[model samples]
Target: MRNSIFLFVLSLISFGTFFQAQKIGDGETVDVNGLQVSLNITNKESVQVGGKPFDRYKVSASVKNSSDKSYTIRLTSYPQIVLDTGIVELDCVNATGAKLTSKKIQLKMKTQMINVSYSAYDKSGKSVSNVLPVIGSYYFDSGDIISDNAIFIVPSGEKPEVNVRALR
Candidate 1:
């Protein structure tokens, strides 16, 4: 067996039984010990800074304990977005951090990566009571599309008639 190191900053529960994953993405759901956890992304706003336009994104994370036993859960999001305006001081914050910024204006924020860690479960099946983290980033480049399977795209719109581009 190959042993691998995890990037988890903090995890208390092993959750071997419900170890679905360590990182999550937008609109993705994870189940742990009869608890349902989901993450989502939404467009917050658009603004112009220094004559440059910028966009803001908001990430909402939530956990629902569906079991009869009372438990606590915490969720955190690690945004892969990077701040790159070519300015040293302006590029200090990350894409995820800028989304949470109250100023509501971030420049050249581009989403590059996103990760979510959940409140681990112990052998005794206990959890921590903490609200899930609200993460945000700029750009909807689908920076967190982590699918191992193949992807197929089917475009559906105003289909052009066959004779439209035929013999003119």
Candidate 2:
């Protein structure tokens, strides 16, 4: 009887752990502390950033508040590109060709923020687009959803896996 009880408890613990650590697939939504996040590669193209042509990817990222509470968060981390060679991360430049400066969000009432890909410029205002926005923090209220796109430069013909921070 003692051995059976011990085995039962062990199995229960294992079962609970298995549920908590489920693997998330590409484009699947993941819940992090009551926030739901989804990231997927939408398209790919070849673009020139600094007189050199490069292959860039358009990634769509969205965040939704799954909780009833309002909270503020900071996006201090950016997504990574997981490749067979190594992991890669790129900076998100704004239209003015400057790096994004905001990383804080005040989500209220389950709100969300989405980042989309657009034309990125340099200091000279030249068209250097296809860069992903740096993941920063934001606030969310219950039921709020934000979606946006970002551009990331990677190798041609290589569909690299996007590694968003929430998946970790």
Candidate 3:
């Protein structure tokens, strides 16, 4: 009887540990390139730019993957940046302060690098017009995570400004 009770208690402890390991949010998995990708965003805060009494916000994006297979993902901006000169650019920035001026961009895991360059051009060979700055970076490994904070700064004056701070 004592042996049976001991066995039961051990089994319960093992089961609890197993459940804790597999437990995740909503049990949801993201499919990426035939593999499951897991991502999460936290520490989100929004504020008006320059206290101009305008509606502006800031969000921190955190992405993660726990699958055994490795995958590559690119963090990209939703709306393209429109410059005052009527040029639409990708709005990507690198550690060296280089900007990516492309339309469609991709970041791969094999290379573990992000390359953003010019992609489209008008009849005059000039870039299209965009106002937002490039706001994305690269991720190389699974279970590997990256984060960035974005801020939209709208001055109280006649112009609206957007500021981005990258938190890797």
For candidate 2, write residues 75-120 as lDDT tens digits: 4445533222111112222212213322211222222345657787
In angstroms, give how far residue 114 of model 3 lies from its true place: 16
- List candidate 3 stretches off by more than 4 Å: 1-53, 72-139, 153-168
Best by TM-score: 2
lDDT of 2 at 79: 57
Q: What is the lDDT of residue 154 in candidate 1?
A: 13
Error of 3 at 117 (Å): 30
Per-residue lDDT, model 3, residue 102, is: 22
Q: Per-residue lDDT tens digits of candidate 3, residues 42-102?
A: 3223334333343232323333444564433444454433222110111122111212212
Runs of candidate 1 exceeding 4 Å displacement: 1-21, 44-55, 72-96, 99-168
Q: Which one wins on lDDT?
A: 2
Model 3 worst lDDT run, 10 consecutive residues = 86-95
Task: Look at candidate 2 and tell me the lDDT of residue 140.
Answer: 50
Could you tell which candidate, 1 or 3, scores higher by TM-score? 1
- Give me the runs in candidate 2 sitting further than 4 Å from their true place: 1-26, 47-54, 72-138, 166-168
